[model samples]
Target: MNVDLNIIVFGSTGLMGTAFETVCRKRSISYVGMSHQDIEITSMEMVNNVIERYNPDTIINCVAVPSIDPCEKDPELPLALHCTAVLHLAKECAKRDILFVQPSTHAVFDGLKEEPYTEDDQVKATNIYSATKLLSERFVATYCKKYYIPRFPTLYGLRQNNSMGFVDKVITWIREGRDMKIADDKMDSPTYSIDAAEVVISLIVNNEPYGLYHVANNGCVSYYDFVIRIKELMNADNNIYRAKDSDFSSEIYKPLRTALQSVKLKPIRSYEDALLDYVNTDVIGVSD
Candidate 1:
């Protein structure tokens, strides 16, 4: 736990990856982070070469084809990125005796549970994206002896790209002065990216136990409620908000609630606290 470590992060440009980089830099951790421009993770050759070059004690994989709609439209990319590439990376990491860590999602569940999910709960994926991720988790469990899969809920941060996170969508509506429709029935825990980054960093530094764990912010809230809180933080007019949900959409097949129950790492802030910091710090106007 005391040694200076070399850590390699994949998907360095994505939300979680960016947070991980910022956290590592701020903590003065020796790390090498790579975006897609640096190397394509799907290529085994590239992954192997990078792993050999860096010789990281720990490898955190933040890469994924995160487009749910696109995954539903075409499952090929999800399979390749989430399943195939991750399996290959796990094999390589195992061969090299490196600790592998993957951020799984609450979407791995079918969303039918009445309460929050735990690490040992049965997973019944209801969509292509979750199915692929679940398959990746299975591969990791089978092939790698030293790995941790911490399943998390929706992650958002001001540093997150506008294209991702529902929080960003709300920020965009407020900035554009447009009316926003939020789902009142859809419920899940919203974990701040910084909070998630801290937990992952702690795991890396401590060589934590190898298993699945649930980690997210303190409480759960519906999309409509989450947006209302954001509006209050941004001081946006609440009169512009409308509530809507699964009763209105065909594509959303999951349950009304799927909040995660973290047994290992508790979030540092409530969703609102982290979100307020985000709104105060990020200067860029949200764009569609």
Candidate 2:
């Protein structure tokens, strides 16, 4: 891998963006990370200015809106952040022949099947949030010939700034003994942000073939049991109410089972192992 390979990471202040920055620095790869405040991806003028300033060979778009409960009622935010912003980056990267890295979620799957989902699985988005995400994937593929779209089941990173992610919040809540409705049936292949960043950035550094890769952890577990493990590992206890995916049918768009596997890339560690490592080292409270 070339250490001098120039890369630009959008959403640098977010979980996945921070992970990519870490990996790039550790590997001695050259890169620039941009937050939402640094650049407005929705505005093509800002995007064009940054492209000219950096003149990077690759652009990784990590901008996203985590909250999705009101996505159907209000598609404006989700559409702009996920679809329109992606459109701008995709078009620019395509025109400049720059490699485009788009990180996607497991929500793209319908979750009707119990088995692990692969990159080749037929994507059936049940709600507006997933629909816009799916639309972004199409935009990347349609516009950019050289692109890397890796679908992760769930990515858990540091809770330093943006502390709204489920895994970190659960860890904080358990330590603080705050109650949360834990879903016993909402299955997902939890992925560590560091591990994901390593795999994805390496692929880009090596300039691998452009296509979708299921870059998720090995096994899957429900949200309830996953939280239970966190408490056990931390030598703490909490009384989280047990619930099922159907309990929050409103989040049906999120899908209950989104276990993912990679047929195109090397398989990473298991979700259990990743969670343990996270709790032992990277875990922090929301207030931290």
Candidate 3:
């Protein structure tokens, strides 16, 4: 990739987008980060206007309706955000001969397999959110000639508020002295946003093969164990208990385990190490 290559990042205000922006800044990579307020993704006119103005070498789209409940409650909104808008962007990238990078989640799997899911594994979207994401992935693959789809698992990092990442919610609960219970039955690879961002930057700079890749932290753990690790790391005195997936009721279904393993690229770091870094950098100032 050329050093002078211009990149455009959509969904710039979200956690993953912010991480990508931070990485781009540190690497001295030129990019224009646009939030939803700057450009409505569901509108083709807005997307085309931005593309026409930037004429970037690459377009990294981080836009999506991530939550399961919201996607289930209103299906059309997520469809527009994740699938329809993505097709428009992919078509534009294809026309401009630009590389399109899309970040996806591990939720595309059904979690029936005991081992970690690979990029080639058949996707079984258990919920509306994952279904939309899977559809978006297909649209990008079908329309865009040059594209990179990196699937990730549970992600956490700095600048992430309570609603975005699970780690932030845990930290908030600890600070508020609220008793919490996390599901022990559900397992996943909790990836750090910074590490994930680094992988994306590496793929772009190295001009690696264009296909689906699984980018995640080194290992997997149940949600309950992850919270326990967080409590231990933060030294919080709050009562945190373990619960099974059956304990909770939701309108949308979630896979019990969606741990992702990357055969294409080496894993970055352990989830424990990543959590420590996040706590030291972002959560140390909060009162417990």
Candidate 4:
């Protein structure tokens, strides 16, 4: 991919977007990152104004209400960002013939299947959050003919306020000398934020085909394994870990194994190694 290509990234303050911006800056790729302070995507007027001003070759919307409980509490908010804002952005992109990319999630599946879900797997969203994301995907498919959709799973990197990212949260708990509680039944292939950003940038710069594709780090593991891995990486005691799955439903109705396969795109590296790199980097929560 050419290094001089310009790209406009939304949700710039988010875990994925922040890592994307950092990668772009490190690579000297000409790009602009936008947060809510820059332009509110929910506002059609603001979306239009920003698009008109930048006229970027591509627009990537990373905005998403990831907290499942919050989404369940207020479905309207997720609908706004995931469905409404997506529709508006799709219309804008269609009108201008510019490439649009929407970063979707793995929650858009039901955990009924025993094997990994392919792109063709039937979607059975079990919660308001997943349903909203599915609605957004439908809208994007219908309106934006020239667009890319990279469905991501648990992207953990440089999350703002350290409020999100299961890995970061676990590290914070350890640093704070708190015991960790993890779900043993829940399963997913957590993607490193850097890997996700790199793949998305590759798709944009390479003018890759416009379609739904999964982008996640390789290797599947339970939440318990994820926690154990983090603790091990931090050189912390494993006894600090505890597991429970009975309350997962009350928190977020998630697919037990929405571990996606990115067979079409270049294969993602293993999460075991990726996690090590992530913890060692300054981007993620590192105790100084």
Candidate 5:
């Protein structure tokens, strides 16, 4: 992309948005980021107003209903945020001839495949969240002339409010002297937000093809093994226990193994290395 290109980022408060902002600042890329408080994405007037104000060359949308249960509880929100709002944004970007970059999830697959999911595989959304995301992807592809949809897997990284990821949740439990049980059967390629951000930037800067792409770290692991690795890395007390998906009951559907691999872009660093970097830089000297 052009060095003078202006990028507008929505959902600026979330993990992915935060990572995008951090990378933009470090690379001296011109961007304007807006959180929910700054703009109501469901409102077309607000969306249009922000786009008119920024007049950006690209719009990176990181907005979505992050969790599955909430989406199931209130389907209307996902329809608005994930589907309608996305269509509106794509239409605007199409009208303005701006590149629309959408960050998607690996949950689009049912995860029955033994190997990692590739971009060419047909999507099998098993839950409301995945359904809405798949719909959004379709809208972007259909409406926008120039678009890049990068599907990512379980992501964890430092946030604006110092929030923790699943691994960090384990650490928190250990610190609180609480017992925890994690699922061993559920598998995914947990991605670091910063690394994902870098890939997105590279995709835009390099002017890659306009289509769906799977963006994730090198390998995959089960939630149980991930937590065990975290405990070993931190050398925390032994309060963690193994469990399975059947151990917990939920109204929402979650894929058993949705680890993703990108055939287009080069593989990013491993989750273990990314987690270690995060722990050392963000967790070591910091106190809750």
Candidate 6:
């Protein structure tokens, strides 16, 4: 599993980005990690410079605003980061014949479908985040002839920042014996970032056909259900209750069901298996 493949990864400090770095380091893959400061994505001049400098064989652009509420409230920055920056990167990848790997979200679908979503399914963006991301996919498909758009489900990993994801919070809260109210109605495939990192690397290393793909754990689970499993694993005595998304009122609208299923590639391990690894190994303490 070793060869010559120059890779450049943007968003090197994010949850998914860090996973990629870890995987590359572990596998001894040749990669140059770049954070927001290393290269300002909004500017095309900077992008061109970096591309020329690294001259990577593949460019994995994980640069994205992974939040629904902010996108809903103000769409400007998300549009720039998600859509405009994407177009720039795709254009560069097309010109240079660099394989573009973009980790998109499962939110592209409206979430009305009962079954897990596949690539052929119709996409309906219900929020600004989805809309911009969907547009980014179009840009990549249209511009970059060689590209991989792996639509990701709810991804979780060790966060370097003070803020933590839902999974992290649940782990901490349960350990502290804090009362919790999780959403039973809403369902999402909570995916592990490390697994996603492997999928992305495999696509490039194995030279898979360039196109849209779904990279998620086998099935989706409700917050209540997920927390229950965590509670059981930890064996903590804390109140964890089932509630609906409607219970807590907010302007942001996330789709009810977004469990991604792949038609092209075999589905990764189940959420339960991945979760077990995260709970047992990662165990990053006290997420803010």
Per-model C-alpha RMSD: 2.6, 2.0, 1.8, 2.0, 1.7, 1.9
- Residue 282 miss distance in model 6 (angstroms): 1.0
lDDT of 1 by residue, 126-244 (tens): 88988899998998898888898878799887453435567766776787778767788788888888888888788767778887878787777888888888777777784544566
lDDT of 3 by residue, 1-288 (tens): 236668898988788888888888888889899987898988898888898898899999988886778888899988998988898888888998999998888989998888889887899989889998999899999998899999989888765333446777787888787899899989999988999999988998989999899999889899999988888878878887889887998756788889999889987888888888878777785542
Clash statistics: count for each candidate: 0, 0, 0, 0, 0, 0
The TM-score obtained by model 4 is 0.93
Candidate 1 has its poorest 10 consecutive residues by lDDT at: 279-288
The Cα local distance difference test for each model comes to: 0.80, 0.84, 0.86, 0.81, 0.87, 0.87
Q: State the lDDT of candidate 2 residue by residue for 1-288, as single tens digits.
A: 447788899898788888888889888888898888898889999999999999999899888877567677788989999998999889889999999999888889888888889988899988888999999999999999999998877788773355568776787688788877888988888889998988898797676889898888788888888888888887776777799777765633567788999888877788888878877776633334
lDDT of 3: 0.86
lDDT per residue for candidate 4 within 221-285, as digits (tens), equals 88888888887778776465456777544666656777877768777789998988988775344
What candidate 1 gets wrong by more than 4 Å, as runs, is 1-3, 160-162, 238-242, 283-288
- Pairs of colliding residues, candidate 5: none
Alpha carbon lDDT of residue 216, candidate 3?
91
Q: C-alpha displacement of 221 in model 2, angstroms? A: 0.6
Q: After superposition, how far is residue 98 of candidate 1 from its true place, in Å?
A: 0.7
- Candidates 3 and 4 compared: the better one by lDDT is 3
Winner on TM-score (1 vs 2): 2
